[model samples]
Target: MDVCHYDVQVKTAIKEQKAEAIVLTDDGMNLTAFWTRLLCGCGTDGRFEPVYVMENIIPLFDKSFNYEIVERESWFYGEYLQAFYTPEANKIVIRDDVYERALAGVALDVITIAHEVVHCIQSIVMRFLNAMQCVEFKTAICSNDSNEMQQHELQTDRITSLVLSPDSLTEGKTDNEILQQYFINPLIQFVCGLIKTAGKNLLEALNDTNCYNEVKEVERCAV
Candidate 1:
């Protein structure tokens, strides 16, 4: 069975292994969607390997112009990079429904591609949240995570919003559609690259900046 279509094995994996969440595809191109996410570099790499990205997703109708989304059957634990109480499989899956978006001639399908990818980034950090207990890993951890898993999730959503702000995507597609599918392009040029904050915050790494900030922020905000 295709990854886009939920089959018995996939269903069993999600059920028995505790798949966290499944996002709807912008179109039936969920595989294309995820594969597109896999290419971590804005430009091509010499050897052509994504340094960091979501798993098994790509794009299909980029030049064609189409968009859609998919949904998960149930909610499971685990954040971005780590699994909480999940069973065995250590990966994420996004499903693409058969709907394509088109405002007669407009769609933010490209940007939404990145937006959904950021959500996967959220799940990756949630796992760290589970491990770190409570921490804030912003900076290079930009795509990795920001603050507490939940807070970081929300903040990253905000960041994604800012990156794909309505105006940023309005050159061609509708503002609303671009906004819906907005996301930050992972620029290795930024101070917030993934390598900057690797392995700093495990559930047990409370002394780390991300962890300390998490504590301080939690105490300060009372969440």
Candidate 2:
């Protein structure tokens, strides 16, 4: 991971839940409730936050992405970010098998986890736009247009970098650079895997929000 600087906006962190596993569907409202507390310091009450992750397959239950998530049994995973989020539902998921295994118990790995959390925030913001009717809502989750989703993925990575290292990417090497060059650059395979099983049913638009100006911009970009 590279060193970068960032201000702390979120303070409360999620505590692990004791549930076995929630079904990867909507009926799992109870699980969602538990996750809301563990995830962002708030629940479905309009508390927006972000999340990030880097793994091959992990099950994540985000009301935002409209899906449940879980980790796979992959022994190997390359560098890259894989996140799924729901707009109407308000949830975000990350797969960090690679980053976790590489860093092991190192404190730096915390950033890896934090990166995925940032995704939750992104999903919430977008969903809020849809709610306010600033953007159009869709039943199916949207796919990335080349680097469209990549922009969000990289943003999460940068967010993690700021929390972990505190130095700028302009310094020697950045976590973003190393993760890309070594993990993602040579391996589109990993990203492809995320696309296939990222686990989402993005069948929702925005719920509601006050960002009229931002909503218009979001609508333009979503199209």
Best by TM-score: 2
Cα deviation at 107, candidate 2, in Å, is 3.4
- For all candidates in order, the CA lDDT equals 0.34, 0.37
**TM-score for each predicted model, relative to the true structure:** 0.25, 0.29
lDDT of 1 by residue, 44-81 (tens): 11211111233322222112222223443331222221
Candidate 2 residue lDDT tens string, 1-223: 2112111111111211111111122211222222333344443233222223223112243322433343643211222434344333444444545344434544444554555554454344334333333222222223443243444455445544443433332246666864553335424544554555443322222223346668899999999
